[model samples]
Target: MVVENHVPLQRLNTFGIAARAMRLARVRSDADVLALVRHPDWRWQDTFILGGGSNIVLTGDVRALVLKVEIPGRRLVHEDARGWLVEAGAGERWHDFVAWTLQQGWPGLENLALIPGTVGAAPVQNIGAYGVELQDRFHSLDAIDLETGAPLTLRHEHCAFGYRDSVFKHERPHAGGMGLKGRALITRVRFWLPKRWRVELGYHDLQRKVAETGITEPSPQQVFDWVCQIRRAKLPDPAVLGNAGSFFKNPTVTPEQCADIIGRDPHVVHYPMPDGSVKLAAGWLIDACGWKGKTVGRAGVYEKQALVLVNLGGPTNPCTGGEVMTLARLIQTSVYERFGIRLEPEPVVVG
Candidate 1:
């Protein structure tokens, strides 16, 4: 258990925002988590649960205990002819775990190769890329209720996953929902892998990459490599620079709205949604407004990836992290003005 106060979160989050936490605690085991939750001093205030801080924006000082979920363990919990099942400690670094699985010849997690953040945060977003999502292979999870400190098991239905959201993120806490406010904190994630893989080519980019290779059957590693290569070219590394992977979730709208946008701008990309809706590429809207690589001062859009917002150096807004908010508002306004569609931010912002 590591405890501290007035911890500067700039170095912690990928956004590099200079925010402060009144109290911060790191837990490496379920016991530590329970202890922290039961701690008399911590039980009375609003708290922020942190993992890798990849998808969070700290706009101001957090006057609460910033509990970082660090419980660490990984093992093969089960295996069968259909697939080998693996369980991961929520606190484990996600990308490293994916690499470990790849090394072990696991087939389920290959397409999620280089995504940043902790394993715990994966289910909050039902993280997807290329043609696969974490939920597609998820068996279930173990989460501790923050209030009662009791361990609860949750299956896929309980997760309420949607595009870039789950009950943990989009919905309110156990208000008959899966949000992690008072009664939820993920501790373990279970996966079901395959003995023989089915190569998912649902996404066009993945299909095009495979088409170029002139192969129908590709090894999991080959598919993984291709996805990684594309991500490398398209996404900026948040380590060298400061950025959350994607700044916004691609907005979903009615087909009629999409058709109207397409009529005006022929290049607008649209992915048909299941229930007669369409998901638009936010990158297209941002690029359409010529916002890519555009910056005000300290905050800027990533040069390579239009979806990413990077902090250049010094303080941006000099006020309310307004510069960062400005970048967000610009993308929102421009997209709305151009296509009448609003791009929603992906990161959780603490104001």
Candidate 2:
């Protein structure tokens, strides 16, 4: 239990937003995490569990105890007729784990390649890319309760996962039924990946690349490399300029709303939502509003990828969330003005 005070959080998060934590503690193992959880200072009051910090915006100095989950280790628990069961620590870097699984010849995560954050956070957002999502490989997880010092095993169904949402993100963001809101910390995640391969050529960019390159027999590794390359070319490196992956989530619209928007703007990019609703590309919408390259203070939308919001340069702090929200507001206002659609944010805000 290494506890440091007033530490800068820029490097911890992929966004590289300069946020400060009053107390930052790194838990190297489950015991370490439990010891800190038992600490009276944080047991009864507010605290925060942070992984890679890729999917959040810090507004200001976080006053609560910040637990940087460093618990590590991974194992391919089983391989059978069905698939490979990969269990990873909550603190493992998601990309690293994805590559590791690929190296072992297991597939399924290649489509979600290069996504920043921890293995734990993947389930919270049901992290998706191209035509794949976390739910496709999800099995179960062990979450520690912040209140009663109990551990809860949440199966796939128990998480109540949806698009960019889960129990921990939605109902738990404020507080949930058992008074366990953000209180449940995912300590480990079990993923079920296929032993065979799945090459999703559904994303237009990938298909375009496949066509241009004439790659008919794309393996999982090839697909992963391509996705990583495309992502690297578009998304700014958090190691350089600060930014969360995507500020706003693609908004889901009703059939009528989608029809209206599509009719009004012929170029609007929309994917059919699982519920028969339509998921409009927030990036396309924002870019259409002429905000792709727009800036607000040091924060602005990524020039090439409209979904990404980057920090031009600013004071070290967390309110990066607010800055992004500003752009999101503009996007929402403009889209509503143009097509009557509302854009929503995907990151967790710890205001």
Candidate 3:
């Protein structure tokens, strides 16, 4: 474990917000984590596990001890006629892992290509894209309890995965619930990739790619390339323009509520889920509210995609997390007033 004081975090997070962690610890292995948790001076300190820093907004300097997960490794744990089981250490980049799996003849993770963040954080958010959620391929994960310093192995059902939600995202530890939240730090994740892989071309963008390329039977790498292409066109590169992709979750509503909104606004874009709920396009709603290409202080909505909130001031004078939240609230209020639906932010806000 390497410990540092007053660590600058502007470049650590994709938002490029200028903030500092009073103390930061980089743990390269489970032994490092256990050592820090068992240390007399640091055992009881409030802590935050930081991965790639893609899905967070730092409001100001953080007082909690920051545990920057840096554990690294990837390997094929098992393979059989049924499928392949692969495991990766928590700190591996998500996109790189997806690509590596494809190269290893595992095709199940292609739909989630190009997403930013580390492998460890994927389960916390139940990250999904283009019709595939992490739960669809998740086999199990190993994490350590911060309170007791005990290691835990949880399966798919134990995660309580929902739409961009998991037990890991909750704060309270319910009696029968896996509300891990701040209590657990994931150390590794395992995925079960089935032998029979089918193309998930249900999403409009994927369908468009299939139609344009005239490749009805695309390989996993082909699908991966296409998803990357589509995302690159819609979302801004964090290196150039600071942003946390998809600033808000797409609010789901009942059929009756959907009908009511449709009556008020005929051109609303929405998709009917497998269940009865209707998922409205948050970007479309924000654009409808005239937020695209607009700014509030140093934070602004991305011109290409309103769903993205960007730092307009660049690195020198970057947008603070406060500015981003302020703009988010204003957009939320306008959206609610006009459409009677509330917007929930996707990224975790911290200080």
The TM-score of candidate 3 is 0.98
| Candidate 1 local Cα displacement, residue 283, angstroms | 0.5
lDDT of each: 0.81, 0.81, 0.93
* Poorly placed runs, candidate 2 (over 4 Å): 171-180, 314-322
Candidate 3 lDDT, 25-124, residue by residue in tens: 9978989889888988888999998999999999999999999988899999999999999999999999999999999888899999999999999999
Per-candidate TM equals: 0.93, 0.93, 0.98
Per-model C-alpha RMSD: 2.4, 2.4, 1.1
Which 10-residue window in model 2 sums to the lowest lDDT? 171-180
Best by lDDT: 3
Ranking by lDDT: 3, 1, 2
Consecutive 10-residue window with the lowest summed lDDT within model 1 = 314-323
* Clash number for each model: 0, 6, 0
Candidate 2: give the clashing pairs: 15-243, 18-317, 58-318, 58-319, 59-318, 59-319
